[model samples]
Structures are given as C-alpha cells and as structure tokens.
Target: MTANANRLEVAGHSVLLTFGPGLETVAEEIDALWYHLRAADDDGATPQIRLDYALPSGDLPAGAVPLPARPEASYTISGHLTREVIRRLIGTRLLLHAGAVAHPELGILVLVGASGAGKSTASSMLGRGGAYLTDELTIITPGTFALTPYPKPVSKHDPELGAKRDLALGGLGLRPAHEAAAPAPAMVLLLERIRDEDEPEEGSSVTRVPLSEALTRIVPQTSSLWALPGGLATLAELLNSVGGALEVRYREAAELEELLRRLPPAEHAETAEIEPRPGDVVTWEDTAPAPGRIAAVPFRQALAMESGLFLLGEHGAIHLPGLAGLVWDLLADAGPLTFDQLEQLVVEEIGEHPESTALVRGTVSDLVAHGWARRG
Candidate 1:
C-alpha cells in the first residue's frame, strides 16, 4: 500500500482514505487506531465511505472532508470520519452510540449513555476479562437486531489516572472482541450516576425500567435514529426481546463488571428471534380498514428508520413503524398524495404484493387517528 492510502473496516463497512503526500503524522495516528482491522489486504470490495484528506490543497476532492494542517488535527479528522460513516449506515443498520462487552456464556452486554457519561471508561474497565465490542458505536443488524461488534480505539484522557494515550483493544491488556456472527444480547444497561465522588464503599445501584420507558430513553441515545427507516419500531422490538433495561448507577466504572456477575443469568427470551427486516411493516389490515389521503404533519423533525418513523415538535413526539414508515416517507416529500399514488409507489418498490395497498391504507388511518397525519 502506498503512503497516501489507508483502509479500515468496521461493522461490515470499509473506509478508505487517500491523504496528501506530506501528511505522514495524520496517517500514522489514524492507522494505529484501526490498521489491525484493515481491509487493505482483503479482496477488493468497494468501500462504503471513501474520503480524500487534503492539506489545504488548491481544490478539494468531490466528497472529501478537508483535513487540518496541525498534526494533532488527525484525531479530530478520524472522529469526524467515524461519525459520517455511522450516519450513512443508519438506515441499513441499527447503529447506537454505546458500548458493549461479551460474557463467557451469556453473550453480549450493552452499555448506553450520553457522551461524557463514562461509557468509554466503563467499557474499557469491563474489557479486562470480557470481550470489548465497542466504547463508542455499536451496530445492530437489520431484522434480527443482532449486534455486530466494532471495537474502536479507546480514548484515555485522564493520563494522571491511567494511560493517557488512545490505544487499541490489546493495548489495554485486552484482546480484540470477536464480532458476533449471530449476536444475541444478554443484557442492556443504562449507565447513570448517583454522585461524582461516590466511593466503592458507597456501593452501586441498579434499577429496572419498563420496556416501554426503556425504549423511549434509548431512542435518543442512537447516533442517527432520525435517518432510520422504521427506527422507533425497530428499537421497540429490540427492547421487547431484552425484556427491559437495568439502570446502573454506580460509584466507579469498574463496578459494572461485577454488576454483570450479580445480575440474573441471561434468559432464553433475551436472545429470542425478532422481526429481522427494516422495511417489513406490521399488518394493520384490521385496525383501520378504510384508507384516506395522506399528508405530512409538520414537526420539529421527522424521519423514517429501517423499520419505524417518528415526528417531534414543541407539542410532542409521535413515532410509528411497519407500514407507517413507508407512509411517512411517501407523504413527507410533497405534503400529501392520494391512495393511488401510495399504492403505485409501494408496488413499484416492493412489487405488486396483494397486501401492499391494504397495509398502506391501514397505516394511514392510524396516523390520521393519532393526529400525526391528515387524511382526506
């Protein structure tokens, strides 16, 4: 490979970056973080996210995010690249901004929270004897919602406390976590805090939340849920499979590792199979038999994920999945369309299946009933 080009693969996506000739420091730092998982040697498959990093060159490449001249700028550029890739893949994959570790027998455990909420700290500490899936982004496969591990370099900011350098999985006395060919999450924990200075003697606490509430809380934690096809419905399915969530408010990040041991054993239901396709719509045939004209309800934001859709505004939030997502996209474009327009488009996209029109009609009725959409 030439000095100008580098490749890193994560979560079934490949990122290839071609840098300007003089940018050796930038390339080295980014590569140190991901080169172990490089696709440079893999059979030549097209990359999903390809970027050209130029150093204030006369003209920028067609789709490249321009790089900074400062050597330290490399770190920021790498982060931006990761975010862009995650955003691009949101519709195809269920990507969450979270952390994960695998158990000897129970399978994968997930940690989720807002940035600076100690997700990385907890994930790094939990990696000592467990598999480190990721400390930043966790990607869930469509339909089955199986989590595919993508362990990125762990960032250590508190050098006075520990290793200040950003290091790969093995750098912290842990091996890279093997990606789950068929992941079945054992547990999902939301990392909360009781106090900043709570000591181990103070002890930690775990609280259980209803699946509905857990689903609501987790939706916002996702990196790009707005871009997902049926995002909300997809998340709801995932939470239902897990039963619910356990809120872990602890004194130290290390406490999470032990919490895993004390928690109840993984249940067969936790890994039970779920609907595994993004565009698959729930059957609404009986709920609202009559179809109506469909229109987009203006909102602060509205989007469709792989299997769900949502709209938010000062008034409130309303989300849907199954056929609702398909309906939302159809109306979102040009205000409202007739039933014929929806059926025609649906048929064109998914084929002239008998249930397509009925599904769209049922979905529209639900939207109208909820006042999230209008029908005429």
Candidate 2:
C-alpha cells in the first residue's frame, strides 16, 4: 500500500498524476482508475477523474503540482481525481468521450457512446489482438486524432470474461495507449447494448443516420464539456466536421471485433460545391440548406449568415445582389474584420446610401447570428 506517482501523456500534453497508497494493487482486475489530481489554480482542491495514460504528456510540465492526499479506504467500484487538467491539456482541441482502437491491417475505429455502452469492454476485447488507442476519451484536431489513454486500473467483473482474456487485478504503472500516431477515425461508431431479443447474431452491425441525432446522443457522453470555456461552440464545430452518423450493435466482443475487421474503412466525404447563382428562393425558411452552406457565424456574441453574394442578416443585405458582392469582397480583403470595421468598409467602398447602409448592417447582423464570422 505504498504511495506511487505516475505520468500519462494525453492529447499532446503531459499530466503529472499520483495514485493513493496501494491503489495499484487492484489495477488490472477492473476497468477504471482511481486517484486525486491537484487543482490547476493550486487552490489545494482535488477533483477526481477516470483518465487514460496513453495521451500525450509533453504539454504538461513537470512539478506543476503534487498529487493530493488520498482519503481513507472505502468500498467503491471506481473513483478519480482531475482538475482543469483535461481542458488545459488539450486547449481547444476536439475532445470526445470515445474509445479509440487500431489494428495493424484493419485501420482504426472510434467507439462513441455514453458510459456503460460497452466502450471499455469493446476496447479491451480489441486490444487483445490490435493496438488500443484509448479506453475513455480521445482528442481530435484538423487532420489528426490523438489518443489520450488514461491508464488508471481495471476492476473485477465477469470471471469468465476476465479469465478468458487473462486480465488480472494489480497496479501496473500508467502506460501509453498507442505506440504510433493515431489516424483520424474513418468510422465513428455509436455503441448501443442489444437487448436479449434484439441482440445481433455473431457479428457487429452498423447503420447510418442523420448527423443531428448522432450529435444529440454523442455530445452528452463527452466527459467534461461544460467545464471548458466556449466548449459548446467548439463542440458544434466538431459535429459539423464529422458530417454524418453511425450506430453499431453487437452481442459478443469477438463478434464485434471480427465485424469491424471485415468492414471497409470509413472515409470523410468532401464538401459539396454550392452553385453560384440564386434562382427561385433565398432564405433559411425556403428550404434548409446543407451544412457549411450558410453556417451561423459568431461575431462576439451575436450570430449571422454568409450566403454566397449576400451576407444576409435578420433584416436583409444592404445592396442585395449588387451590394452583397461588395460585402463579400470587403470581408475577404479585411480578413476577419470586426462589425464596426465592416460597416466603415461598406461606407468607404459603396459610399453613404442610407438604405444601403441599413441593408449592409442587416446582412452583417445576420451573418454574425449564423456563426459564419466573428467580431474580432
């Protein structure tokens, strides 16, 4: 029961962590980790966490803070200690509460779902033959998905499964999840447990669904979004980037692994090209445009829409087709100019037409509302 210190690198950040005395004694038997993390503010508070060890630790500096003292032993399935560690480690990087696994020949699959959806079981099952990216959370950025493996400890469970897999309970210090860089998830799987009657026979089955529904189910599973500043906007961007949804259901771990191995790798489709000319209709209400077509640009705290030639606002574009072209040109030229600057630019470029000024202001307002551009 000696106290021990360990470090795990997740999402390109190094996290200095420590476990309570003798905590490692029970590590291998279960599927979770227990420890107390020092507060980021150095406020002498401890926040718990169930984290991965494989995440990058380079971002965490050494001796940042000492691990907090452990509480008196009590019977519990799992416990954790965290601070602003996860958010600070990744910054604005795309974070997901999903398990990431990779195979030498089979590629990578991201298992996304709420806790108790079999992510740990599935990851452990797959890691028997392939590489385990992470059993909990993963961070993704443009063109890369980094696995921040939190190596806490595993708990006791089904004897048959544990024995069959040779899983034992004992503290082995933290270990990285993957040896090589993790590729972006070709397929994002939302895992769901099958009811007795609904269980699929011998293989994993995948089905596609709308992106909205997928985001709805997947967002809540993310370990700590609310804790991160401006996390909601970041999450929305991530959902938009993934583009679609998928559901995976299976009965047995082996069956699911086999199914994943047999399936083709998932690919992100290129954004569809938008036609230049406007014809019959021209508003959000007319017909829903595809994502990226008219994204709500966030300016400061307001929202607006950038629709082709016109920067439509809640009111209307200043010059409609003619003036809209000028607005776009201004935005392109100025490069993320603020609303005040944009208004001034409009006056400079098109001169002082009251109706035109009103129109431009309206369009800018709308674009901000939709999150196409920001004030700063």
Give the whole-model CA lDDT for all candidates, comma-separated.
Answer: 0.66, 0.47
Off by over 4 Å in 2: 1-84, 146-180, 197-204, 223-243, 261-376
* Candidate 2 residue lDDT tens string, 201-310: 53457666443355457656664443344443444344444444467777666677566554433323222222223342223344333433322231111111132232
Please, what are the lDDT tens digits per residue for candidate 1 over residues 29-148?
777777566775856887888777776666765565567756445556657666876877766887787888776654677888876578878888776776777887888876887777
Which predicted model would earn the best TM-score? 1
Query: What is the alpha-carbon lDDT of model 1 when measured against the actual structure?
Result: 0.66
Q: What is the lDDT of residue 356 in candidate 2?
A: 67
Predicted structure 1: clash tally = 15
Leading candidate by lDDT: 1
Poorest stretch of ten by lDDT in candidate 1: 267-276
